[model samples]
Target: AISRWPNRVDQRELRQSEIYKQGMQTRRRVLGDTHVNAAEVQKSSFDAPFQELITEAAWGHVWSRHNWTLRERSIVTIALLAALGHLDEVAMHVRAARNTGATREDISEALLHTAIYAGVPAANSAIKVVKNVFAQLDASGE
Candidate 1:
């Protein structure tokens, strides 16, 4: 099948676009320099396009929007990831929550809502992920 995305030249232009720059900033802010740096270090040609797509679309377009604060987006993202059984991402966002100013109470409350709406198993699994992440954070004194 024909690819629907732009050609390589256009994709190169997009990498230099203002939105991509904004996304990188927002991504680094939310995920932290350590995590973003590790991800960048691990980036390879195979997944480079995927990374850029998410950086531009998710971070730049949705996350960088002014309608909600970073905390709000962080909570929502955690809930959605949990709902979709994206437990690894749930853990990631839970760690990012600290940077977004989301407290443990806020995350607990969000998980409560996730339990009611997304189901018990999903929320339960996510809560476990959160606990592990929290333990790591506490140990690191972060």
Candidate 2:
């Protein structure tokens, strides 16, 4: 259970919110249960609030929008993360891209576009990370 309104609603009621339910479903769909479980497992008291915030805000309010397909959102996120040198998130998103129906070629194209605006060096690093993620995925037969 989680509480978006920790001060107002109890944890059970918070989890019952349409926003929270939709967010958890979307998060599990886009990110996968394994990754979500890992994060939930590792959550500490200090970071639990932050985790809930992202799950509700980022996944619920923003990601749940019907304006764009999940594939489109994943592509945009990959480009932004690569451009910003958020290599860790880049890797995570790259791995999750498949769940969103993003092919490796799509990710490559996104990174290539990022190079034009985000710089060749950033794209270069992201390319390396992408290759590694693909290799891991391939090995896992995912």
Best by TM-score: 1
Distance from true position, residue 107, model 2, in Å? 0.2
How displaced is residue 34 in candidate 1, in Å?
A: 0.8
Please give the clash total of every predicted structure, in order.
0, 0
Any residue pairs clashing in model 1, and if so which? none
Candidate 2 residue-wise lDDT, 10-113, digit = tens = 54354445886788789999999999999999999899888888888889988899999999999999999999999999999998888999889999999999
lDDT, residue 72, candidate 2: 96
What would you estimate as the lDDT of candidate 1? Answer: 0.93
In terms of TM-score, how similar is model 1 to the real structure?
0.91
Q: Candidate 2: where is the Cα deviation over 4 Å?
A: 1-16
